[model samples]
Each structure stands twice: as C-alpha cells, then as structure tokens.
Target: MPQADFYILPSADEDSRYQFLGKLATRAISAGHWLYIHTDSEHLAERISERLWQSSPESFLANSLPTEKLHAPILIGWQPDHIPNTPDMLVNLSTIFPSQTVEFSRIAEIVIQSDEILALTRGRFKEYQGAGIQPRMHDMRKRSS
Candidate 1:
C-alpha cells in the first residue's frame, strides 16, 4: 500500500496551503522524488505553478504544467484523465478523492482549518483506510506555534 500523509494547516486561506505545498515539494525533490500536484481545475494548476516560481526568495521551485512538454521535476495537472504515471508522489489539492491512488508510492493531502475542508479530509482519510493504507497526520498548527 502507498504511504499517505495528511498535513493539516492552521489557516483556512488558500495561500497558506500553497505555501506549505511549496515546502513539501522542496523536501520531496531533495529526496529525489518526482511529484504530480493534482488540482481541481486548469486555472488552479496554473496558479500553483506561478506560486512555485515565487515560493522562496532565495530560489524558485521548478515546476511545469501538464501542457508543457518539458519534463519538469514537478508536474501540475487538474484533469483526472491527465494524471501522469511517472511521478513517485501525488500532492492532491483537489476537493475530490483521486480515483487512481494506487499508482503513486506516496500521497500528500493538504488540509486547511475550515469546517468544509475538515469534513472533506475526514472522508478522504476513511477512503485511504478503506484502501488498506494507514494515513499519517501532521498537525501543522502545532509546528507553526
């Protein structure tokens, strides 16, 4: 079974979620992992790609949209049918559970502190458990304190 990690953020803002995602992507890349960041729409995918470029003041994380032919370290996509088979990790930013979860060795689900988000993440947690994958939780709220 693939390893699943849920990162619960302190804030409900979208910026906070994407900031943490940039950090996660940096760590994963350093550990030699290719990542596929799944979003709910093409606009979001583009938004994330832009944020990654300014993720850090010292350096920017190299990422590419699925439309780009370049084999970037991180590939961001929104469509379910366009999920890349090569990435070792999947960073799910979408509200819906990814149907093709078994394809990746690791999965990262970023959740914010909101009623709707918490409820959605809870369902995803159960789905992961149902798939025989014991997901780990990281309360980022404590980490930031």
Candidate 2:
C-alpha cells in the first residue's frame, strides 16, 4: 500500500509554499527517489519549475516538464492525463485529489494555511483513508517553533 504524507504550512503565501517544496524535492532526490509534482494548471507548473531552478543560491533543484523528451528525477506536470507512472513519489499541488494515488509508492500533499486550502486537504485526507492508506500529518508550523 502507498503511504501519504500531508505537510501543513504555517502561512498561505505562495513563496513559502514553493520554498518548502524545493527543500522537500531536494531531500527526496538526495534519498534517490524520483518525484512527480502535479499541479492544476500549466501556469502553476511553469511557476514551480522556475522556483525549483532558483530555489538555492548554492545549488538548484533539477526538474523537467512532462512534455520534455529527457526527463530529470523530478518532473512537473499540470495536465491530469499525463501523470507519469515511473516516479517513486508524487507531490500533489492540485486542488482535486489524484485518482491514481495508488500508483506511486509515496505521496506528498502540500497544504498552506488558508480556509479554502484546509477544506480541500481535509477532503483529500479522507479520500486517502478511504483508499486504505493512513495518511500522516506533518505540522510544519510546529517544526518551525
């Protein structure tokens, strides 16, 4: 069974969310895990791709879009039809829950502190549970304290 991990951010700022995603992607890649970042739109995917490239001054996180012929360890995709099946982990940044959740060995759901986001994530949490996966919550605010 696949495992789901929900990362709850302290702020609703988009920059903070992307920063956390960069760190998470770096850690995942360092651990030899291939990651696929799923977004809701092409615009968001492009934004994330840009952020990952400019994430660190010392080193940038290498990522590629799904349309690219040569894919890096981390892939960013917005279209629902192009979900890559090869990645070991899935980083969901979309509003809708991914139907192919079980395809990946691990899943990461990033939720920022906001009423709308909180409600969406709550539904996603239940969906994961319904699929027989016990999702773990990581309160990033607590960690920052």
| RMSD over all Cα atoms, model 1 | 1.0
Per-model TM values vs. the true structure: 0.95, 0.95
On residues 1-145, what C-alpha lDDT tens digit does candidate 1 reach at each position? 7999999899989789988998999999999999999888999999999999898889999999978887789999898777886648999988887889777899999999889989989999999998889999998889886
Clashes of 2: 0
Error of 1 at 91 (Å): 0.4
Per model, state how many residue pairs clash: 0, 0
lDDT of 2 by residue, 72-143 (tens): 888889877778856489999999878887889999998898898899999999999898999999999988
| Model 2 TM-score, 2 decimals | 0.95
Residue pairs of candidate 1 with colliding backbone atoms:
none
Off by over 4 Å in 2: none
